[model samples]
Target: MSVRWSFSWEDEEWLATRTPPADNNLKLAIETLIVPFGRSWQAVDNYLEVWRNMELEHGAEYSVSTPSAAVERISRDTVEIGDLYDQFEDVRLPVDEFVTLLTDLSAAMRNQ
Candidate 1:
């Protein structure tokens, strides 16, 4: 199957307030990631809603991986990091480091 990868805010608030990426590859990457959760944007949104609620209530973690069963831990770590950020605004790496990490992650996902 062919996949398109792209990135955009899937939430209504962000969607209303922000402009989507103009870069085609970035857009494709975001779309590719959303496909496994569900093939439509709305499905991804619904999953995110449930996921966020689970994180809030029970600190649940979720992962997205190719092969559908590889059980990668990075996504789980990302969730935990986000939780940490919510609890402690000062508990974060530098912006450049965070960007590099995410860039590497996106590369890995693309390779998969």
Candidate 2:
């Protein structure tokens, strides 16, 4: 199955809220990670509602893979868990290459 890997910090907060203790964790995730991306909390709320339904119906697995190894490989400036979409843009990897990378990422996550 294909996955959508967003580096938007807004998206991260949305993911955090899907779990229990929605407010605290959502705040933490936003302040610590999402805020730097210049996202609005209100927009995050709207997107979360939409994404939640999609994930539930389609079984899409949204994930954050900030493994130490991956971080080291990508380097700190661009490899941070909250900056993947930026990295994806910077790297400008072709669609085929990106699919290969995602495939590899999935395999690694599964192995772990």
Candidate 3:
């Protein structure tokens, strides 16, 4: 089986998402995109910028927890908005797969 991004409703977590997130995995779905858009604007790279930066980041420098250090932690190929305090368990994806999610979604949205 493979995984894909999605905007969902009617889940056990739906009610919790309504009020606020206690920190959760950043799902790169349409609805999930709205979370970072509304809450993490500083970290939200524009769609084009996300792709542009991918060419710049060279190595896999990332963390499993929310980013708290004073480093340029954001990678061009990765969206490492670690631990958004909306839920538990950070969702980690391979760099290429992660970028594919953003690119594919971007294309789909453009077509619509």
| lDDT tens per residue, model 1, 1-112 | 3222223345421111112222443323333333354324444444445545655665434433322222122333442122211222222223233233344334433443
| Winner of 1 and 2 under TM-score | 1
Measured against the true structure, the TM-scores of the candidates, in listed sequence, are 0.29, 0.25, 0.42
Instruction: Output the better candidate (1/3) by TM-score.
Output: 3
Please give the TM-score that candidate 1 achieves against the real structure: 0.29
Model 3, span 7-93: residue lDDT tens: 222432211121122234343222443343333323334643644453455444533222321112355445444434444343434
Off by over 4 Å in 2: 1-33, 36-39, 63-82, 85-112
- Flag clash pairs in model 1: 4-28, 5-27, 5-28, 5-29, 6-26, 6-27, 6-28, 6-29, 6-30, 6-31
Error of 2 at 42 (Å): 1.6
C-alpha lDDT (0 to 100) for residue 91 of candidate 1 = 26
lDDT of 3 at 83: 37
Pairs in steric clash, model 3:
21-86, 22-85, 22-86, 23-85, 23-86, 23-87, 24-86, 24-87
* Over 4 Å off, model 1: 1-32, 37-39, 60-112
At residue 77, what lDDT does model 1 achieve?
44
The lDDT of each candidate is 0.33, 0.32, 0.38
**Clashes per model (N, Cα, C within 3 A):** 10, 0, 8
